[model samples]
Target: MSRHIQDRIGRRLSTVFPCPDAVEDTSRLGQVLLRLAQALAPAPAGNPVPDSFRTDLLAAVPQLRRYALAQCRNAAEADDLVQTTLMRAWENRSRFEPGTRLIAWLFTILRNAFLNQRKRLRREVEDVDGAFAATLSLEPEQERRVELIQLQAALNTLTAEHRETLLLVMVDGLLYEEAARVLGCRTGTVKSRVSRARERLALALGTD
Candidate 1:
């Protein structure tokens, strides 16, 4: 190894990669370090379907729905997209890089499926003057439903990129790096989109 490379490593100044299953602190700096390590590590080759794959996938359904609704704005269409994504992910299990984050993988599949279907079907639904809010629900069932309507409308006004970014980072709690992976974009792009989305939503809802 060159002395320059060794010096970089000794100082921990080299770039770090991200890995799916590496659990670390929630802080942004911590995530950055973890991702750096992940990036340096070789990808797990082949598909050794983990025992939790099915269960984990099932668990991710609600998140998938939230993302889908934000993307397509219709409840039924969101459900269909989730279904299609799950089906495709399952069918392509062998292609999945092992030891990676399942949700990110599934999300990538869902996103691609959504984009492809949008191209073919171009199906549009009435957003009820409000797109569904991923975070809606406060009081009584009926009242919550009403609030959700308004939230949905506000959500619909956002650009698709903003909506998807908010859903991934805010709703799903994915780190920016993880979100970038799922969205097939850079971490900087994910961060920017989330910032813009939050500002727009705050303006729309008049929240602090």
Candidate 2:
């Protein structure tokens, strides 16, 4: 195995199987280590989570909460959604594909969780799409600034599906494929939504 693979396996093993130092038998310790190494090894075709997975999760929570809050109406709901997302991600960590965009994956989880919660509680009163546009519709003294704000607000007026597609593509800088994965849609769908969203925003802001 390459050094990279070995390091990854070592990290996973440490997380899953902490060695016991109380055992004075050298042979037993060796056996335990061997068992752990075997268990931590990657499958034939699948990439296991890297050592940095936990570190990445820790680093991403703040940004993830911010994104969730932007999508949600209230701080309490956003915080709950973020907490649930993190718990779910940690629980299903093994299923996360390696070398993928972790932030996108987390965002997808948060979005799904939010939708599910809304369905359960029937509390979909505040429309983020409308709120997003309203926030951006401010008139500033600077002509250049006002125009930019208007454009941003126009983007917010798009449907949830469209706004998400555009933000994931334009603001989040995700490629079509990655955005599709995050949105749980096909690449073609993502492309169409992004195109339609841009056109609508342009029309809404009288830039068409």
Candidate 3:
């Protein structure tokens, strides 16, 4: 097997067979191999499936729900989106590569599912004055409002690429490298886009 596959198998093994603490004579490598065999062994008769397989999905549900709610105007729709995302992830669990960041993978799945749903519902008219719009709050100060309005307008004017990068970095608190990974771009591209976006925002706010 390739080294990458071996490494992945090794990691999965470690999670399954942690070394005993009291044994002084057991070599670390031996413990690792033992763990690997145990993890790869056929399931015992009547034994339930491992819970670790669902660890990523369980951990990500709250975050996924929050993200969905933010993207969808309706709470009911957001719940449906989360449920769909979970179901899709569960069905595709076997395709997930070991040792990858499962949460990131789940997020990607949720994002794609949401975008697809959005495309399907594109013909629906949005409410301009309902709870969705009212959920948006303005800044307390008049100056802050003006600044925020200017920033919001500038954001609306930006290309989707620029806006997404900026929002992912600033609003979502993703590091530039992580943001680039999500965007499927190079780190340098993320940096450049972020820098340009800041400059554009500053100019739009008349602070440049």
Candidate 4:
């Protein structure tokens, strides 16, 4: 891997898989890592995956889950999208060009997979009216739940293009050029979309 790629993967690894000695418990991260490991287990006998490729792919799972959750708005669906992205990425590992942004390539696959799945799964119900929220047990963190609901509702109001661009740049930490590659658009377009997305999101949250 190139120096830049190594740096990027190292940063992602620190977030997705923190030093075990520093953190007492990482059951959540462990679960995600285990799922991704299983996803990559069936590589062809003769064509084994390289250590660097596996490491980079594993490190990207957290960002993938965030983007998937923003798009799907349901934890189960987001998990499925992430698993599908991992599976597809592993299967097409040979097509990936080295010395390039692996996360960008994975984002492209993830976005395409999400779009294809959306077509078949349009009937899935959403909590647009907050009816589902009413059913949640009133816990100490109910205020936090309400805030998240408001944020998700604000996110849902943006155009698909705006939402995707904002998530790629702001949430996933993709540079403008890398996000442009994933979105198949000009860097200027990505910038404009993110700017507008922030404005629209703020307006939706009644902060504009």
Best by TM-score: 2
Q: By the TM-score metric, which is better: model 1 or model 4?
A: 4
What is the number of residue pairs that collide in model 1? 13
Tell me the tens digit of each residue's lDDT in model 3 across 44-74: 7764334565444555555565555545656
Candidate 4, residue 136: CA error in Å? 14
Misplaced by over 4 Å in model 1 are 1-48, 122-128, 131-157, 203-208
lDDT of 4 by residue, 182-208 (tens): 888999999999777666545443443
Which regions of candidate 3 fall more than 4 Å away from where they truly are? 1-79, 93-102, 115-134, 206-208
Model 4's TM-score against the true structure: 0.63
Error of 2 at 96 (Å): 1.1
For each candidate, what is the lDDT?
Answer: 0.60, 0.62, 0.57, 0.67
TM-score of each: 0.61, 0.64, 0.54, 0.63
Candidate 2 lDDT tens digits, 1-208: 2445333323322222122122222544334434433544553556554656756765666656556666776555666676677778877888788889788888889888888888998976464544433333233458644555555556556677876677666555578998898888999999999777766655544553
- Candidate achieving higher TM-score, 1 or 3: 1
Clashing pairs in 2: none
Which pairs of residues have clashing backbones in candidate 4? none
lDDT of 2 at 77: 67
Give model 1's TM-score versus the native structure. 0.61
